[model samples]
Target: MTMTMTMTRSLTGAMAAELTSLRDRVLDAAVVCVDRGGLGRISLEDVAAQASVARATIYRHFPGGRDQLIREAVDREVGRFWRDLAVSVRHLDGIEARLVAGLVEARARLEGHALLQRLLRQEPGDIVSVLAESGPAVYEVLATYLEDLLSIERLRDGVDRREAAEYLARLVVSHISVPGGWDLGDEPAVRRLVRRQFLAGVIDGIEPDR
Candidate 1:
């Protein structure tokens, strides 16, 4: 019985690994399809063909079909997007500079991303809804990054790191989603604006006593 259990466990582990590999391949193929033909243009058949997998296999992995696959692909892409942003701001001096530079860089990158452009142009409602629904997830990602970059002493009383992170994330997303006549194209102007609007609360040496 012990030997049988060990064999079964090993088999399960191998199967799980294979499934993960297959899922990643499918997601990679889906990303390529999105890049080439945009979100609305591709079908499950297109993804299957791109991944060199059968339709049944796609269904087995992604039972929710096209929508599920698309959501997962977008999630993966968003993670990559933030990781790139993190790297861009990693070398900047101080939390303030990092936040300012990171926000500006994120806005510029998001605006210029081909996938986002296609979605905004071709399927505005769908993209908007997706972004709205994913807001919390985005906040979590940004907040985690901020928590790492920021010192506890810098935050104001009653404002935890998560709250501060969420505040910054919301501020950035709001600016990106709706333009308010500010010249976001100008880096210096953006930095100043960010400092005045969002960073004012979290600036160093402004912490209140507990």
Candidate 2:
């Protein structure tokens, strides 16, 4: 019975791994389609063809159809951006430095991203609407990363790290979405804004001398 149970568990794990790999392949195919012919030109059929999978197989993985697949692809892209940002700021000493570096990197990344530029140019409203719908989830991702940075820097005192992270994340997103009067293009200005507006309260209880 124990051996039988172990074999079952192993099989289940293998199936899960395969499913994950298949999903990634589908998403990669979707990304390729988007890159090749912008967001508005792609369809589930296109994705399936590009992925070399049947339409039914694509639907099996993404039950919500094309929109769901697009959302997941965007999420994966955002996750990759954050991972790259994390690496960019990994060696920075303090949370404040990291925050400044992160914001700068994020702005640069967004401005320079080819896929995002294409989407913005060809299907601006669709991408903007999708981003609005995904705003909370994006904030949560940023806040979670901020929490890790705070913990690592040993600066998670006094302030509610999660709340502070959310606030800071919103601030970053707002700047990205609409510069309004702020010149987000200037790294020095962005750093000053991050330090004065966000990090000040985040490290509120830390001693000035420290």
Candidate 3:
């Protein structure tokens, strides 16, 4: 009985891992196809051939067909971006350091994402439509994430954790969209901006722990 249970657990784990692998392959292929051509132009056959998987397997995993595959692929890539952003700032203890790290990381990821840029350039309307639906949720998620990090921060007397977090989130979103004068990828400039203007409004002063 013990052996049976142990074997059952092992098989379950292996199956789950295999499923994840299969999903990743298909999503990667879908992303590449979409990158090469726009979403409207990419077909299920293109994804299948690129992924080296049968169309039946893709349908089994993504029953909604090509639409589902593309949506999930985009979501996965966006999730990966946020995860990387979180990791980039996790070690920093101070608000200033955290802000600088986050801004730099976010910009770097944005600049590096080829498919994201291609979609934005070639299919602006589609990207805008998707952002219209997902932007608010993303804002909330970033605000919550910032709230936890900034709770211990020494903010201005009138400022609270929630307010500070939301403020930073708004700034981040704006800066990423239209970083006209400031350079987010420059660590020194970002740190300077955070110290001089960015946090000047929220906190009287913050010397992020070195």
Q: Which candidate is the best by TM-score?
A: 2
Per-candidate TM-scores read: 0.82, 0.85, 0.83
List runs of model 3 lying over 4 Å from the truth. 185-189, 196-198, 204-210
**Local distance difference test, per candidate?**
0.79, 0.82, 0.81
- Candidate 3 TM-score over all chains jointly: 0.83
Flag the better candidate by TM-score, 1 or 3.
3
Ranking by lDDT: 2, 3, 1
| Model 3 per-residue lDDT tens digits across residues 18-100 | 99999999999998898888887989999999999999999999999987886787777767777778888889887777888
RMSD to native, candidate 1: 4.0
Which lDDT tens digits does candidate 1 get at residues 77-105?
77788788889988987767776687677
User: What is the C-alpha local distance difference test score of candidate 3?
Assistant: 0.81
Kindly list the per-residue Cα lDDT of model 2 for residues 1-210, writing each as its tens digit. 999999999999999999999999999999999899877778998999999999999998899998899899988888788789889998988777787777777778888998898788889998878767777787888888777767655443577878887887888788766677757777777777876777767775543321
Model 1 lDDT at residue 71: 86
Angstrom error at residue 109, model 1: 1.1
